[model samples]
Target: MCTLLWQWFSEVELNSGELYLYHNSGTARRAINSNKIFGIGTPRYHFFNNLFWTESWWGNLCSDPPNWIGDYNVYVRRGESPLWDTQKNQAQAAGIDLHGRWAEGEISPYRDADEEDFRLMEKSPALDAGADAARLDGSPAGNTMACLFGIRLLRYGPGGSGRGPRRRDPGRLRARALRWPARE
Candidate 1:
C-alpha cells in the first residue's frame, strides 16, 4: 500500500506480527528480516509526505521494527514536555522518517488545516521536503501532491496507459522536489 499526505490527529501504531529464533543443537544459524515489517508479510507498505501532531502529552507515533520504509514526514507535539526523542528514536530504527522535521507552532503542513486545505504553502516545511520514494519501494519521490499529479497526468493525459505511463526515463518527482535525493 502506498500512503501519502496523511495527517494523524491521534497516535499511530503498527503491527509486525511476531518473530521466532531457531537454532541447531550445536550449530549457529542467523535469521534476519531486514525488509519485512510484519516479519511474515510482503514488504509492500510505504508511507510518505505525512504530518503527525497531537496536543496531548501521551500522544505518540510508532511503527513496527525492521521492514517499513519512509521519508519526508513531520511529527509535532504540543505540551510542556514533548517526547520528541521517543518518536525520533523509534522511526530511525525502522529506516523511516530519515528527513522528517519536528515543530511546535507549525503543526499543519497545509495553508490552513482547519479549512480542510492540505495544499502546502510556499514556506511549509513539506513544500520541498521529501525522500526518494524509489529507495523505499521503487516509487517516485516527493510529497503526495506530486505523486497524485503525476498519476493523473500519466493516466489520463497525453497517451493514457491505463496501467500508468511508461517512459524512457521514469524521472524524479517535481514541484516539491526540494531536498530530494539525487536519482540513481
Candidate 2:
C-alpha cells in the first residue's frame, strides 16, 4: 500500500495545504493502515488487465483499499467498514456516485490478445494432455502423475504457515479423517 501511496504522492503534485499527512481514515482509528508494502505498478493505463485499477483525483480507498483489512481496524469492528468502503459507500449514500473508467474484467493490464492468440490456446498441447480416451471415463490407465499433481496443486494450496495450529497435508483429507477407524 505504501508503494502505491508513495507512487501516487510522487506522481500527483500536492499543494501546501494538501501536503500528504499520514493519519488514520477515521475519527477513532487507533492506527493508520497496516504496514504491509503493496507492490505498485508504474503509472500507465493498460486496457486489457489493469483497466479497473486506477486512482481518483482526491484519493479514495474504495477506489483502492490501502491496508487490505490488516491496516484498517474499522473493518474488524462490529458493523464498521474499512475506510475504503466507508469512503465509497458514504459517497454513494450521499448521492454522489463515482464510477471508474473500466468495468472489473474488461480492462486488463495484459495486452489484448489478437484473434490468433485466442485460437492458439484452444490448440495448446497442455489442454490435450490427458491419457488416451480410456482414462477419461474413470478407468485407471496409469499414475498420470503430472495431471494428479496439477489437480492437487490447484486444490490444496498452503494458505498460511506450514507449522502451527492450521497445518494440513495430503494424508489428512476430509474423507479420510471422517472414515478413520476407531481406536483398536
TM-score attained by model 2 = 0.16
- Roughly what TM-score does model 1 have, to 2 decimal places? 0.41
* Candidate 1 runs further than 4 Å off: 1-43, 53-66, 76-83, 132-146, 149-184
Ten-residue stretch with the least lDDT total in model 2: 43-52
Give per-residue CA lDDT, model 1, range 53-131, as digits (tens). Answer: 4442122122334443445655445443444566557667656557666556744445666686755555554444454
* Alpha carbon lDDT at 81, candidate 2: 27
lDDT for model 1, please. Answer: 0.39
For all predicted structures, in order, the TM-scores are 0.41, 0.16
Q: Which stretches of candidate 2 lie above 4 Å from their native place?
A: 1-52, 55-57, 60-82, 98-184
Clashing pairs in 2: 1-38, 34-71, 47-108, 48-107, 48-108, 49-108, 49-109, 50-108, 50-109
> How many steric overlaps does candidate 2 have?
9
lDDT of 2: 0.24
Error of 2 at 13 (Å): 24
